[model samples]
Target chain A: MKLTCTVNGLRIEATAEPRLLLVDFLRHQLRLTATHVGCEIGVCGACTVIVDDEPVRSCLMLAVQADGCRIETAESLAAGGELSPMQASLHAHHGLQCGFCTPGILMTLEALARSGQLPGDEDGVRHVLGGHVCRCTGYQHIVDAVLAQAR
Target chain B: MKPPSFAYARPGTVAEAAGLLAQGDGAVLLAGGQSLMPMLNLRLAAPDTVIDINGIAGLADVRRDDGRLRIGAMARQAALMRTPAVGEALPLLALALPHIGHPQTRSRGTIGGSLCHADPAAELALVAVAADAVLTLLSSAGTRTVPARAFFLHAMETVRAADEILTEITFPASRPGARCAFRELARRHGDFAIAAVAAEWSPEGLTIAVGGLEATPRVCAHLSRELAGRPFEQAAVVRLIDEELAQTEPLEDGVIGPDYRLQLARVLLNDCLAEVLPP
Candidate 1:
């Protein structure tokens, strides 16, 4: 099956099997390896991406389902050579250690921030970012980073 | 995990989608595909064809008319949660929406998909039962509305025929004095609930629906009847929990034991009732 969708800012078309996950198509077919796949069952938030301005689990969505949708991955967050606010926050606060979960976290937070309803306080940031799990950072710095960004 | 080889059809209209479903013996509707994707990948479901309903027109609108909230089958959970009418008119649903999955899953997960998937522990199932939401199922023959009470027969079992596509879900506007709360116990923040309860309190009576603890969402009308005129105290709440557990069987799997789930049900029920009930 040939699937065409707007990825990042570019419209791309590729032939894929009906069973291919959007995450695989994005990483393997499109070579956008920044969108990592973890906990393929959708439990881990490591496969998050923005589809139609809303964050979703790319691993849990088929490539065909995204045939006409706009997809933004972690790579899209950083344009030109500068990092997105989420990436900058994660870096400044050392919110990532292994960095495997960073992309998913950034995508999820990016969606929240894009909604323009993100809180402007520490507790508010904690509540907003509480949905994503991080094995590293003890979550304090991640929380701190979100809080810093909120301010 | 890749899904089994299957033909995929992206129909532009519900009539086309319904026709596709009627043609294939084991055709399944693909909406958000949050649950279906995992099931397909695991090979738990191997339908010969998948009728992609995302392209279907007029299935993604959320509208309110004639005192009822009508949500299209394709309306995403995130979209539903953000709709002011849903938050204002169907507070229970709005409250349960955030608990379905994380924001990412909710972004694409649809209300109709959740109800049709009929997970015994799904928050939407409990909310549907508690709110007495009506499901609109469509087939080539026509359309019919099934009350939530009769829609779910067992765990992951719905009354929807293989050829029927769930079109919409409608619920009466929440009463002015109605208060609802949802409580669940999960291994982690986003894990499936071990046991959960959705409670709605009205001056007429209370409606408590327990999910994840039974084969299907169980509505304890007896408890609601008994709780009438009685204060929702610790003892009264415990009695209701005891009666609910006594009437329904908890789902037992590798994750949690039945006894543990029964106990958690009691704790969650009490907590939920305490929040909704006056002191």
Candidate 2:
């Protein structure tokens, strides 16, 4: 099957197996490894990505399903070699320990912020952040970072 | 893990999709792919063919007709919260939407998919049963509507035929002054509930469905009769759950035991009833 989509403002097409997952296609074919795959099932949001401006579990979507959609990953956050606000906030708030879950959380919050759906308060941020699992930083700093940006 | 290689077809119409499904062996309908894709990747389901129904037009519409809230099969879970029609017509569903998975998963999960997947712990199926929703099933032969109570046969099981497609579900609009509430217990926010309760109190009566404690959403007729036309009493609800759950024969569901399941069910039921009761 031929998979085609705009990733981070670039339109690209590649041949992939019908069973190829969007996460694998992004990581392997596109060489965009920032989007991590955790818990191959849909439970973990580690494979989260923005498809058509909404966050979705890339691991649970096929490359074919994304054929005409506009997708944005964590790589799209940085601008001209500068850290995006979300990245900078994560840094200032100490949001990452091992950082395996950082990219997915960034993409999830990126969509929330882009769509003007970012929560305005701590509880709201934590509720939205609850979608993505973070094994490190106890989610306090992550919540702090998101709340910082959410403000 | 990679899903087993399978043939895929995107049919442009419901008739085409139904024909494809009927002709192919182990063919499964794919809507939002939120549930089906995960099952496929886990190798828990290896259908010979996947018939993507996203291309089928008119299946995603949510309309209100003659006091019934009609939700097309492809109606996404997120839309229940975001769409004005769904938000106003189906407030119960709107209340339950955020609890489905997460905002992201809800963006791609559909009503038909969730009901067809029929997880006993899932919120949508329980809401459907609580509302006594009616489902419209279509196949190459014809169409039929089944009550939500009869549609769900067991966990991950339904009365829907292999060749039939669930096209829509309809819930009668709530009566004036009716109130509904949903409560569940899970390790995390987005995880599946260990035990859950969805309840609605109205002129019709107190309709309730308890999930994650049985193969399908369990409705206590005796309790509903006792609950109608009266203020909620926590002790009575707890006693009813105690007497009923003792004979439930809970399955060994990996994490919790039968006793714990009953306890959680009681707690959730009490919590939900308290929320929906008159102030």
Candidate 3:
């Protein structure tokens, strides 16, 4: 299937099988490797990306389904070659170690920030972080990073 | 890790979607795909044709109609959480919405998809059974409405025919002085519940529904009848729930045993009752 979508401000037109997941379309076809694939079954949250301003599991969505949608990946964060505010904050807080799940977490928080739904406090940030499983940092640093952004 | 390849069709209307489903070539309707996608990736479901219903018009609407809340089947859980009609009119559903999944999943998971997926522990299914919502099923032939209670046949099963698509679910609009509480016990905040309970009390009566107990959300029908429109002590209610639950077989999963599930349900039921039936 021929798929077309705007990704990280780039117009992408690619051909993929109907079963090709959006995460693969970005990582493999579009060469946007910042979006990592953890558990393809949607539990790991490493596949999170913003589609049409909403954070969704890209692996759970087929590339064909994302046609005509506006998508944002973690690559969009540091597109300017300088760390985005959230990314910089994550770094300052040591929010990531292995960083396999960092991209998805960043995109999830980006979606929340874009929608002006970023929680006002640490607990609220932790609540939103409940969706993403971070094994490396124990989520304390991640929560601190997101809270720093909110402040 | 990858879904099996299949022909994909994006139907512009429900009728076309139903027609594709009626073809009997192993067609499956793709709604939010939060549940189905995982199954597809895991090779649990391999359909010959995947009918994408996201393009269908008016399937994502939420509105109040004639003293009832008419929610389109495609109404995403996140959309419902933000919808004023849902929050103002369907308190039980509103209470259960946040527990469905994480924000990312809820942003794409549809209410209709949740009910149709019909997991015994799905929060939406529990809300539907608790609130006595009515569901509208559409097929190539025609449309028929079924009360939520009659919709579920068993775990991950429903009376919905293979060719039919659930189009809408109508929940009773909120009544004045209606108090509701929803509680779920899960390993994580967004994980599937091991035991969950929803309680609603209005002038009309008290309705109790529990999930993760049996093949479907179990409406404490007998207990509801016993407590409806009447005031009762907490001890009496607890004893009643205990007796009712003791007679039934609780669902047991690898996460916990049936005995523990029953125990959790008992505690949750008590907590929910305490919230709405405060002393």
Candidate 4:
């Protein structure tokens, strides 16, 4: 199947298998590997990405289904070789250790911030972070990083 | 794991989708893909044909129609939270929506997809039963409306025919002064409820529905009627609910026991009823 979508302001036109997940297409076809695939199921948010301004599980969506949609991945965060504010905050706060779950969290927060839905407090940030699973850092630093950007 | 390769059809119309469903040996409708995609990746479902209905028009509408809150089957859970009509007319459903899944899943999970999935612990299906919502199903032959209670046959099973598509669900507008409450207990936030209860109080009567303890949510009809317009007696209502729950065999899985589910049901029902009923 032909998959066409705008990724990080770049028009991507490629042929992919009908069953190819959007996460796979973004990583393999586009070679934009920031989006990590943790659990192939939607349980893990490591495959999160922005589709048409809303954060969605890339693993849960087929590349064909994303045709013509505007997709934003973690690769879009640091375009000018400089850390984006969220990335900077995460780094300053030591939000990530193993970094397997960082890309999805960053993309999730990116969509929330873009939509003006970022929570202002720690509890609210933690609530949104519930969707993500991180074995390292115990989410304390992640909450700090998100709270820093949220305010 | 990845989904098995299969023929994919993005139908432009419900009729076309229904035709694909009717013709294909193993055709499945793809709505939000929040649930279906996971099942497919896990190889739990292997449809020969995947009918992508996301391209169909007018399937995501949420509006008030003829004094009823008519929600299209493809209405995303996150979108429903933003919809004024849903919050204004169906507060119970609005309250339960947050518990369906995380905001990430809710962004793409459709109410119709959840109902069609027919998970016993699904918050939307529990609210559907509690509100007595009417579901409209479409097929190549015609359309039919079934009450939510009758739509769910068992866990992950429904009366919907293979060729039928659930198009919309119509919930009667809440009456003035109607009070409703929803409560669910899950291991974690956004997890499937171990036991959940939805209760509504109105001048006409009372409706209470409990889920996660059985293959389908159990509507406490007689108990609801008995307690209508009466001051809530905690002990008496608890006893009544206990008696009612005793009749239906509770579902027991490896993690949770049947007795624990029944206990959770009792507590949740009491908690929700206390909020809506007169003290």
lDDT of each: 0.85, 0.86, 0.90, 0.91
lDDT of 3 by residue, A37-115 (tens): 9889888899899999999999999999988999999888887699999999999999999999999999999999988
lDDT of 1 by residue, A30-141 (tens): 9999988887777677889898888888988889888889999999888998998878988998889998888888888888888886678776665556566678788898
Give fnat for candidate 2.
0.88
Order of quality (TM-score): 4, 3, 2, 1
lDDT of 3 by residue, B1-279 (tens): 689889999999998898889889688989999999999999999999999999899999988899999999999999889988888898888889888889999999999999999999999999999998999999989999999999999889999999999999999887889999999999888988999999998778888888998889999887778777667588788888888797677887776899899999999988887777646
Model 4 / residue B180 / CA error / Å = 1.3
lDDT of 2: 0.86
- Candidate scoring better on DockQ of 3 and 4: 3
Minimal lDDT window, size 10, model 1 chain A: A123-132
Prediction 1 TM-score vs. true = 0.95
The list of candidate 4 runs beyond 4 A from truth reads none
DockQ of 2: 0.83
Q: Candidate 2's residue-wise lDDT over B50-81, tens digit each?
A: 88887789998988899989999998888777
State each model's C-alpha RMSD to the native: 1.8, 1.6, 1.1, 1.0
TM-score pick, better of 2 and 3: 3
Q: How much is the lDDT of residue B100 in candidate 4?
A: 81
lDDT of 3 at B110: 98
Q: How many Å off is the CA of A102 in candidate 2?
A: 1.1
Look at candidate 1 and give me any clashing residue pairs. none
Residue lDDT tens for model 1, B1-279: 678898888999888888888885988889888899888878899988888888888898888898899989889898888899998889998888877777778888898898999988899889888899899999988999899999999888999999999999998888889888888878766578888888888777777777898888888787777775566678767876787679777788876889998888888888888877767
TM-score of each predicted structure versus truth: 0.95, 0.96, 0.98, 0.98
Worst 10 residues of 4 chain B by lDDT: B239-248
